[model samples]
Target: MRRWRGRFLARLRAIAPRYPPRREVDRQARADMAASSVEGGLPGRRRANPSMLPRRIPLYRELIRATFQPE
Candidate 1:
């Protein structure tokens, strides 16, 4: 058990830089993509759907549209 654990840790250290954990790499990649794809200051996650806006509040909808122009 001790030998296996040591080997595992050694292997992990060796591969840490060459191949970081998938989830972390994916998250960083997603952040980069979001930054590059941004039309305004807002990220991809905050993208608003105009159709979802309430019909009763046209002013608020217009403000949102003015703030976030489509790319």
Candidate 2:
């Protein structure tokens, strides 16, 4: 058991430096998303459908159209 544990830990330590920590990976992903968004890259997630707005809210529909379909 002791030998196995030692081998496992030694292998882990040797491999650890090859990968960034989870938090660092997440931070980098967020930064990349922000940069892409600023550059008008494709959205990472689906956007809401403007057609889903109630007919009573013409202003909302117009705003959505104006924002997404710029003349």
Candidate 3:
């Protein structure tokens, strides 16, 4: 009985290759599709430092600070 059960389980396992679970497959598919140019997507983002400004715009910071100060 043990031999037969083992053989049955083995045959069942052999019949199928181990595929990633459905959620992982869906996530990879989404990532791949998004990576393609046709999908019009970017991988990540960048943010500029708050204090970083062009030398030409030195007065812009002072102007903004004065404009928005609480009355």
Assess every candidate by TM-score. 0.30, 0.29, 0.24
Model 2 TM-score on a 0 to 1 scale: 0.29
Q: Runs in model 2 with CA error above 4 Å?
A: 23-71
lDDT value for model 2: 0.38
Candidate 3 wrong stretches, greater than 4 Å: 18-71
Candidates in order have lDDT scores of 0.40, 0.38, 0.34
Q: Write the per-residue lDDT of candidate 1 for residues 11-54, one digit (tens) a residue.
A: 44555465555433333333333333332233333556433223
Highest TM-score model number: 1
lDDT digits (tens) for residues 1-71 of candidate 2: 34434543454345436543333233333334333333332232234533332332455334333433423
lDDT of 1: 0.40
Question: In what order do the candidates fall by lDDT, top score first?
Answer: 1, 2, 3
Question: Which of the two candidates, 1 or 3, achieves a greater TM-score against the reference?
Answer: 1
Question: What shift in Å separates residue 43 of candidate 1 from its native position after superposition?
Answer: 54
